[model samples]
Target: MDILLNVVNYILGFGAAVFVPLIMFVLGLCVKMKPGDAFIAALTLGIAFTGMNTITSFMTGAIQPAAEGLADKTGLALTTVDTGWPAMSAIAWAWPFGVLCFPLLIVINIILLVTNKTNTLNVDLWNVWNLLFTAVLINYACEEAGMGTTVAMVLAFVGAGLMAALGIKIGDMWAPSIEKITGIPGVTVPHSMTFTAVLMFPFELILEKIPAIQNNNVDAKWLRDHFGIFGENSVMGLIIGIVLGAIAYGELQAALTLGIQAATAMVLFPMVSKLFMQALSPISDAVGDWMKAKFQDGRELYIGLDWPIVAGSNELWVLTILLIPVELIFAVVLAPIGNTVLPFAGIINTCCAVPALLLTGGNLIKMLILGIIATPVYLMVGSSFAGYCTRLAQTWSPDSLAGMGENPSITWSTMECPDFRWVLVNGLSGHVVAIVLLIVWLALFVLLYKHMAKRNVEIKKELGR
Candidate 1:
């Protein structure tokens, strides 16, 4: 029965991805839009959903293996007694320190959202995942080749860290050059030093929890808060700090438990929230844009609530309080029946929050209603198509090594393999969806172009000598 339900839910999820876009098209047409306009909107929503899913899946694939290798080397068990997902060991070890750092992360994400700037710091989430994965792969290779764990960890850390640092720095420096070449002014890289430091918090926790490195007295929490240490502190000092902290903490098991929970919350909650936002974004944007056009008399109103603000808001607090019982009910009543269903509840919670935020905008009730109707339809179509494509790519190339064979040197395979696949899948999906939707959007753009051409012909006819 549980398996049947899960299969049903997965089917429903895929359906929702397809359904959401079709609904968006119908809503657009109801507003007297040309077929082209409606189609474009639907297509754009589809593309966005697909792109995000693809990137997310690719990152997950790359990171999970590395995380597993790191766990094995550190003597952490790989299986969760409950779900059996790779225990997110690094995150698990850092759980205790996370308590001190979680609030700060919320603040940083909120600031970024409110400022409306794309932060480079946000990219570090991906970078850390990638680097950690790379470290794991390298460590695995070392062990397979008969190197000691100590040597493997050291080499992996140094190699991955140097690569990460170089990639980040080069990307930052070249961003302006690319923008200039494209003639776009005022574009800056996202994620300040502060944001990057905060992003590294989970990784720091992982480092702290490793038993072998327990002698290093590293204050993971303190380093997370201090940019100078991360930026200029000597490598020896960092290692020493970790060794000392582990020794001071004493109970490796307890420290590991705390670290896992903290890192889990840090990664899982933010990711869940992002997924909610992605699911909600098209609807929110459509509704907000419609309301401003129909009701706002040239005054700008913030209709969408950014995720960070939502996480920090009093409303969220109240919602969390309300949800506690609901979560408990699911755990107690539902988990006995099946545990996988619980994660879906989290997804549902996020989905519910989107419509709530849209409705709360007050002045845009009609638009909100339209958005509520349209969101699910878009999500159903978009997510399914994206997930399918991403999974296909993963099946084709399960590892970076397979994707980039015969390259003994590192030679940018990290970026090259994943980047090429991501661009190809995302770009193709976006363009194809856009074209298909254009046909349904009332062909307003096409009609306008034809009308202009006719007018030019008439002018030529009138001016003939």
Candidate 2:
């Protein structure tokens, strides 16, 4: 296959800060480690992914030119042009079934971990390009319904392998509260934007059965113990970068240089998530002691990873700077009532709501009411998949539409995957209204995964788990 697309484009051209710490120093010398602790745990996970890409490029260079100067001073005549997620991952790697969807999702996650269904060994292979951006837009909407392109690449690779087997059952329901806050037990985070927090677990159990939001018990360690060090988290990201640089640069020296680059991205995103949990705790303890000397049924394994190791909390940077002006004023007053396409680009405030604010465990009022009702349903499902993502970026990456400028006629990406419910279930899959909206969203995720697995066994018997 053209030498596996020239060795996956020469290891994605040495990018992810040199191929994710040279694939975690060759997965810590394929679990045998001790080559000077896998070269100091792959040079401290490539210096914690170059200090979380230099504090996410100083918080997207002070919030993408103040969100393209509030979408060019709010003259909202929107015509698709949001263009973020790296030009929709260069039109999902210029489709033709996106370069064998990265070795068919690493051979369907190693045949769902050698057929024991799954134990989630996903190994965040470069975020499998968000599952090959919804399997190259559902293999170009099942090759515009005539199918055959080898049955539209096996029906968009079994609908992106059933969304990575429902993101490994949402990383086995948040791997025991992320191994009780990073002691790093099994591990999780099967990603696709933290599996859209299973569409907000039945609206956070109907806002925790509203006895006034169940006594609101505002979290983030009670705003760092009732505002002690100016309620630190890098001083509330220097007061939300001096109120988003005084509402987009009404300068007090560019709002204190975007409040010292949002207080150095809230104090270096938890010191680059404690150097990516000290380089994934000795390769997650050498893959849980090589799955206990190669699995003798004590089973338990997880790993998966990415969602910036539980997105540096402090209520996910105060509900990502109060939902960046409520996702740019709800994409300018609900993009003419949800017909979609307004965001000029702020990458849905903190890269598509930091995987539903670490699946709402950092409950800044339930991630600010699920980012004010899912940032206008991700700007009307990224404006109903912005005309088939601007006709799959002018038919397979016209040099990513001449590098996003040649004057935007159309483009889209408020958080990736040729979006808006993957263009309403790959433009209504083979029809019958996308199999009755995929059996009513799989019977509302089997009654919200049996009411969040009986509210996670009554929150693990009220924490005496």
Candidate 3:
């Protein structure tokens, strides 16, 4: 029965993944958009952003050894999974919800569009999916490559920003020349692509031979010097040689630190300006360049402005605060509900965070409500289905469990035994305590919201709104 159930569950989970995207595409079609457009949007939202779990899994597998080695070197416990409240909740629930809540997400988005008078469906903001996906992917890549979180975040921010900016800048600069040369309307040489490709081999070499340099502060100067090399041939050689020499000297820590900081500054400068563009003519330079390209009938004008880069509204901090309780409820309450019907079923809770974050527009309150309501249903229905599918996989691939015997070895018995006495005492009880604390936090948030609402009402009355 367990085996049969696991099979059924796997099929159901897979179905949900497929169905949700299809429904989203259909919704797009209803709005006179192409199916491809809808798929792209869904991909941006679902697979691109929320699929960080898959990237994390890959990175975890790759970086485990490096992390352990770092721990051995630094003697700091920086390698362990963050098992704190909401992070723990994410571990327990985010992935499962990602898989199960596809259809519900479509329904929710539709509702939000229909009901909200002020909030129009900004397809542009859907770019958040791209940002989320890229962040996670880059994060995993850096971590797996032995880069610490701080270093990775800095590099990612710098690298992505520089590449994006250079691409736009170079494209703008070369637009007229490219058009005159090629006679193509929207086709122009991608300066960013050239820059990236040029840097790739050298970057890889640096990462490979002198892995420790990832901790360094030399990245910024390197980018600045190389930033001007598109014009000069000999300068390019000099840049390459310097980069190689730095890596050979294993000054990665310095290089990385400097590079990240510089890159961050470059990226954030424009973003900050965009933020206060209303008060100041910030990014006026870039805007002027864009206008020149458009006036000149250059393809470079198509390199649209990345509003997020221009506006420092990452909102990650806001999302984190809002998501805490939702994560807690799913990890603590809903996970157990699934486990009761299906042994080894607690892992499915990892899916809950996906819907909570994506569907709720990263709103903490909505996520908390959804987590309270939806997790139980997912666990009951989704886990039962997933558990059964896993059993089926085992049955089908007997060699997958070939080592098992009627009288399995003591070690195996200890490891695989269903006995949960210690687990209940340690894991369950500890989780329960965590959940209680989360509930208190939620209560405080509710009170805060109420107070804010009252203040808003008072302001509205004063203004006669």
lDDT of 1 by residue, 396-440 (tens): 323422443442111110111122122222222334654354343
Better candidate by TM-score, 1 or 3:
3
Candidate 3 regions off by >4 Å? 1-8, 11-20, 26-40, 43-47, 50-70, 74-439, 451-465
**Model 2 segments more than 4 A misplaced:** 1-69, 72-76, 81-111, 115-118, 121-136, 141-150, 153-155, 162-181, 194-231, 248-299, 303-385, 389-412, 417-465
Summarize candidate 3's per-residue lDDT along 95-165 as a digit string, tens digits. 22122222322343345435531121222221222222223334344555576878765554443342333
Colliding pairs, model 2: 340-383
In model 1, what is the error at residue 59, expressed in angstroms?
0.7
Comparison by lDDT, 2 against 3, better one: 2
Where is model 1 more than 4 Å wrong at Cα? 1-16, 78-465
lDDT of 2 by residue, 248-319 (tens): 767788878878888878787876778777877887788778777888877777777666666555566667
Local distance difference test, per candidate?
0.33, 0.68, 0.31
The positional error of residue 419 in candidate 2, measured at the CA in angstroms, is 13
Better of 1 and 3 by lDDT: 1
- If both were scored by lDDT, which would come out higher, candidate 1 or candidate 2? 2
